[model samples]
Target chain A: AQRVTQPEKLLSVFKGAPVELKCNYSYSGSPELFWYVQYSRQRLQLLLRHISRESIKGFTADLNKGETSFHLKKPFAQEEDSAMYYCALKKAGSARQLTFGSGTQLTVLP
Target chain B: NAGVTQTPKFRVLKTGQSMTLLCAQDMNHEYMYWYRQDPGMGLRLIHYSVGEGTTAKGEVPDGYNVSRLKKQNFLLGLESAAPSQTSVYFCASSLRGTSGVAGELFFGEGSRLTVL
Candidate 1:
């Protein structure tokens, strides 16, 4: 079975400050990781995936195999960044299915 | 395109009552999933279908049943609703399982169910 752990339940930061949302996973085989975000009154949507290796809305994540982590980071925080973020993992197998973390509520204060 | 749409956006049910939630996707994706979201529990998969005419159990499936009779639609049924079943249900779809692991999910607006 695959599992994802997002250590922080809530993270608050001041505008212009750097922020990081930590995430860890445990899977026997190679895993695929992704970040999904939900804004107020909106549907959950994909933020980014490890394979893409691209940044969305100034947020980026690097999958660390040795440490078993895939933390999301942003150089500077913006108030508009406030939302709930979830980290998910999919293991390699014929029935590979997604496993999501508890989620972290990020608050970017002015 | 109506990427993903869930019917009965909000519902209130009584214990022992039955209800069914409908999910439809216009994307022609081959994978559809039903998940329930609670305060601190995040998203827990209730049921999923890899394709039409097939459905499988997910993380939390004991209290739920699913049917995927059509390629573009999936339905979740609760024979007897309970307090624990009151949650925000989300329906999502993706291209295909072999299309790779991180196939981004296109989710619906979600259905808020309250059982009292």
Candidate 2:
């Protein structure tokens, strides 16, 4: 069984402040991790993937195999960054589906 | 391109009534998935298909049925509507990859369903 957990249901931060959304997963096999964002009145889109090792919209996540975590981080929060963030995991084999976390509602206050 | 499109953006059904949500992708993706989003539960996979004429159960498959009769269309059916089934439904598609590596998912705007 594969499970992803986002501990915070809601998080708020002032503009320009650093922000972090925690995510942890439990999967017996090797995993691929990704972050998806849903903006207001918009469809969900991929923010970043661990395999890419790149940042999107100033957000980055490092997969920690030892800790079983893949936390999303941003150097500075912006009002436009306010949205629902979901952490997802995909097993490394034939099962090509994603298991998503509960999600974190990020609110960047101006 | 329309990417992934889900019909009936908003729907309301009475308890015990049945309805089907349609998803169509124009990108010729090999993988299609149906997910339900709730206030606190995030998105749970209802069902998915790896290719045409193939469907599989997902994380939350109970009370929902799906079909992938064609390569570009996936349908999700609710046999009997219930209040607990009310949520926003999303349809996504991704290209098939070799060696289990997955492609980025493209999603539809979503269909909002409410069971009264």
Top candidate on lDDT is: 2
Q: Model 2: residues >4 Å from true position, as ranges?
A: B98-101
For model 2, how does the per-residue alpha-carbon lDDT over B1-116 read when each residue is reduced to its tens digit? 99999998999999999999999999999999999999888889999999999999998999999999999999999999999999999999998874333558899999999999
Candidate 2 structure quality by residue, lDDT tens digits, A21-82: 99999999889899999999999999999998899999999999999999999999999999
Which pairs in model 1 have colliding backbones? none
lDDT of 1 by residue, A3-106 (tens): 89998999999999999999999988899899999998889999999988999999999999999999999999999999999999877653435788999999
Error of 2 at A11 (Å): 0.7
Task: For candidate 2, list the clashing residue pairs, or say none.
Answer: none
lDDT of each: 0.92, 0.93
Docking model 2 quality class: medium
Q: Candidate 1 chain B: worst 10 consecutive residues by lDDT? A: B95-104
Model 1 stretches astray by more than 4 angstroms: A94-96, B97-102
